[model samples]
Target: MRNPSLAPAPGDAVGALPSHWPRAVAWALVAATLVHAVVFIATVANPLVISDAWYFVDVFLRKYVDGQLTLGDFFAKRSAMDHALPFHKLLLLLNYRLFGVDLSVDAWIGFAFAVATLWLFRVALKRATPARDFADWPVQLAWVAMCAVYVSLNTSEIFEWPLLTLAFVALFCCFALYLAAWRALEGARAWPIVVAVFAVTLVSDGGGVIAVIAAALATGLYGLRTGETKPALRAIGAMVLACIAVKLVSWALAPPMQSIPMAGGPHAAAVSLPRLALAMTVPLSSGVLYPMQAQQVFHSFGHAVDMALRLGFIVAHAVFWWQAWRRRPTAAWFLAVATMLLFYGLCAGVLIGRVPQYGEAAFLQPRYIVFYQLHVVALLLMAVCWYVERRPSLDPANTKRVGGAMIAACLGLVLLQAPLDRQAWIRAPYQQAYVQRLAVQMEALADKPEVAPDKCMPQITVCRMPEPVRVRVVVFLRDHHLNVYSPAFRQRHGFEAD
Candidate 1:
């Protein structure tokens, strides 16, 4: 209950906010979630990227920019993944200059980025909430609960791979850009910010294409609905032209996939619509059941329960989004859902088209889960906003009932996840083992100066992690001055790929 004695007078700073409902319960949930995430990240030990950092520092910026190796030679030879990443390159270069390759520092940087993104998400939710719902603490707590679950599910990709910051940055960029376009429809002057963010996003990753395409689609539709046809048309045209330009430049910088040995093989199957549908329905609290990217997972009653809970979450979430959309029926709501769904729905296609094997195992990958979780969270926020707009409340009984239920549900989901969180941390040993095995050979090579610069550490294998890191690590150490291979010597052999 709001304190009658201390209630803010109308027109006062505090009084400007929804004054009828007490905000203590909602803020508590948000604060607790933030604290939990921070503490967990702080305790993480020796987290390493599956592959990018090693090669990025040792190859892309170091050799490619020095003019010692041609784009085709260095790219075809040293590139870990097929995509050309200006952002990744810049990150590697900046890190090299700022602090060198310190794993502890790098891990924290990623954690900070995630924390920042989470806060940005919180702000977004605040902006989306209708004025009538501003005092609806129950819905606010529910949003916090959903966000906690979203952060918990994608630890593998989010915490481990610093390079994935590109995706994180792009996701936020797209959402904000979509909103800017929406404002343009409403005659707000926010397109410059949209254009700037979008331009940087173009170089982040191939995944960024999902954001741009989705944003464009959402903006174009907004024009039709709002009768801002001319403004929308010009915005769409500018966005499309920018996207094309970025693609052309990125392609020019990117190595040809045909240059890789795998591309010569038989073509893989394209992802189907049904698979995309299944991806969309994954339960919000069902993350523990997924096991993310852990090489070895401990299964128990909780896992089984998680499976069932996810099924329930799927059904509940679908209905929730529909009800929210039905309530609001606004272009903003439509665009938010549409943009996110496009990103989520395209996961299968992007993976299948890039690496058929990845597409086959798309459901199991933690990296993909990040995008999937975003779509679900976006839906929830949009729904809650509309639901509140139509049904804001201030009664003590209403607060007790709605807030109690929402808080219980959110807290219940977190308690159920304790076992999985334990499992996620214990696997740090496996990463240690993986890193140790490779580190030993690296040390050996560093000690033996006589080994051929190109031939040293010829075949590297890391078993404790997933399958992508082998080619990644090998290419990284190939041209570096390890094993006492001098800079001149390493530079001379920059054309070789491990």
Candidate 2:
């Protein structure tokens, strides 16, 4: 039976020809993505390496840039205590080496990566959608617009974080798999593309086991739909093998985490589900009301409201997913759901082992989930497109209604979150000033002839300064390792020295 939702084929003049609408939309998407990227770079360039990004940059500068990979620094001395992953550190080091130590250079590198990621998404959409006429224009436009929004909204963390880089790499791998599957189904030799996809997939993330499983399920579903199972099975097997090989190699070459005190395995497993759900809901909500704040009277009401908002967000995501499954049972949509669930599960498991005190634990931070957020957003966009496409006989009035509702919902969310975004931006200059102050102090100490090179480790305390000044001084001293200071010098400066 013919699919009821399929768009009617155009006449002979347009047969097998790419439509002008899709092409125009693609160009506009490219432009929008570029503009958002530019704005992101401009906003984040000088902010103090806050949170995980700072640690990643520190490790990269000390270990990769200094050529001390064997016995190098992780994010911080504290990171060694917590078993920090080296992947982000490595990327930061490469960025520093290629572009120099300037924060501006890092900003530009991030912007470039953001642009590349958008182009990759565009390519993936073109490969995944089956429609060939002007009707496909809306689908293409929606996909690009969603990506643009994600890039703009999450730039505070995702643009500079190595985890986001890993996510992009994973998306590119998925895109490659889509192309390879298409080629294989068409009876073309696609082994090379499969191999390339496998390679990229392996290097993208440590949790790539989850991605590989999702890819396998996607390939299996595609094969079943098309009545060709062997090639898909082979592709899945290849992907699995690639993931295993990468993990083995990483285990061998990277520093062992055994010495670091891991959160108890059982504990880690226990917290997985709740944390995953929390992470998924919190960022999508209108305000940040961390669960830990519920104990405080002032924030208790806000916390309750936040919980309600989270439930609403999850329901929204669920509705979109259901619509996609009903309209299009494509491999991509299925895979997107699988990946989201797997990642969420893994996150829940990991959270159980870590400290559960929400405020003190870094894992509770929403930015940690930025990697999976891309996939979630992609799935939602695909669902929306599928929903629109399924109403093939949709009248102009109904179409307008659906389109208007979608736009209104999105705009409302943006408006509701505008306060948070503004606060983040307003605080950026303060972070920049703090970093600049620390840098100046470090540079001054580094220039002093009396400070020995061996004492330049970050642990030394510069005690002489006032509390605020001392905090920056300590950060500076830790950064440069100026450990030995004369008590006389402290007296001269009207401060205590250690």
Candidate 3:
């Protein structure tokens, strides 16, 4: 049975495509992907094991390898975040067992998932556009533009980093689960996929909570439309139960967290205002910050123009969401609404989890940019849907004007954003610095169990790791022949092998 949502919209150009058009889209995607890879290699292709990768190897992998942490503990063990990292731990162990701690393997695995996320976004965009006009230049260009920004270097912290790959894992799973639930809402046999994704979501990071809620809401909305409430109710009930279960298990196993009062005081408004402002602006600020971060062409714009651009995007999205909501519910509407939910939900999570410690800066971190990037892409799709729906009826001259303006905006954004993204990868600031420090520490620790007795080795303060812990991990690496101490790693990095 065909889904009502899949039926061609009025004046949709679905069947008007030329035979070669599909190939054009495919080639365009291919080109975008190649550029993504090239930018990754050019910027962040460092193979050195560093930071959280070492932390995981020390805490989780080392314990597991030494028979201290069993498989059961692996599933329940909490990381420094005080949240279960079963999936992340399992992946780290699997990589260790299969290939013996290769950062490239970890990075490439993350890169693959990043590509998969882009592909899923493409699928969603194709479905979400009301006109489904693949033959139209604007629609095709939108896909290409989305592909470019989806892999933007601003998100390298997740896509290019090995230990931090959990972000992409959660991201890809969220996208997959949402799409599968959408299919089920449309009356497809996607329940199994939904179930599988939900199971994975339990072990993932906080983003999984948003994924399940958004999906359940989407399903519940379907029930409202069809007047069939039982299945949706059951699905929502199951999700609630699963969420409770995960939280209970985490609270039981994880250490007690120090509570910070984020509200309910005379100064509450002052404390909360910055966080709220940062959260609201994250969707647009990422692109604005990236160009400025590049320290090249966009550096001239300074703080005032940057703030203006950020606020402008926020207001534009507000109008777009309102317009999307006023329209009848469709797949695109559901996607836009759900994505909006995700955007704010993630921002809320950041507020609660990070704002106390990091302040408003937490919202601006590169790691958080990946989530907002998806929001931006969804908004772009929504904009395309709005324009394409009206294009069929607009005067030719007016259509040309609007189309030309959109094209200019798209190209301008790409041109402004891409260089900074590329520059970030090229700079590869933290990765290069952290690895160099690790190498120096590893070398110093060589021929001894630790660094010189009187000397304190320089530390990467960003990691908040203690010197003793670093010394112990380095000793373990030497003894176990892992990471910098491993012969393979030594050979790869041009260090003399013992």
| Number of the top-ranking candidate, with lDDT as the measure | 3
Best candidate (score: TM-score) = 3
Clash counts for all predictions: 1, 10, 2
The C-alpha TM-scores of every prediction are 0.71, 0.65, 0.82
lDDT of 1 by residue, 1-498 (tens): 212321322222323456544357656755776676565555543323234444444346556446564544322333334555565555555654554333434545655655665565555555555543545555556556565656663454455444443355555555556666555555566556347445445544455566666666766655544455686677667667776776665567656543223321344556667775554444243243454422234435545554565677667657755654344324336445655555454554545454454443455556555565665556555655444443433465774666576557656555645655666667655644554444455545444423423332322322222334433444444444332123432233231223
* Alpha-carbon local distance difference test for all models: 0.51, 0.47, 0.62
Model 2's alpha-carbon lDDT is 0.47
Candidate 2: where is the Cα deviation over 4 Å?
A: 1-33, 46-93, 103-107, 128-141, 159-203, 223-228, 255-280, 283-309, 320-325, 329-335, 338-346, 349-364, 393-397, 407-421, 440-498
Residue-by-residue lDDT tens digits, candidate 2, 1-498:
223232232231334666677567657655855675566556544422333343333333544535665633432223222433444455555644543333344455545655665565555454445545223445554555545444544335444433443444444455455455545544567565447544444444434455556566666765555455677667666666666775565556655443222222123223456665555454444223333322232354766766775687677667755654454434345435444554454455345423353322435554454443444454545555454454445676886676666555544433433443454466566644554444444444445524423443231132222344334433443444322132332333233344
Residue-by-residue lDDT tens digits, candidate 3, 1-498: 543544555666555445566448655655766566665654454455554455566667778878897545544433233445677777777877776676666666666777787677667766766434544556666666666666666555665555555466677777776676666555666455446455546547467777777767766765665555765676666666766676666556654332221111113222568566755575576743543463354566655666776888778778876766444445555666566667777777777767666666667777677677766666766767677666767898998888887767666556655666656666676766656655665566656543353343333221234556656666776787776667877787555555
Please list the residue runs of candidate 1 whose C-alpha ends up more than 4 Å from where it truly belongs after superposition.
1-32, 35-39, 42-50, 54-58, 64-81, 103-106, 130-132, 153-157, 193-200, 220-234, 252-310, 313-321, 329-335, 392-407, 414-417, 448-498
Question: What is the Cα-based TM-score of model 1?
Answer: 0.71
Q: Which window of 10 residues has the lowest lDDT sum in candidate 1?
A: 2-11
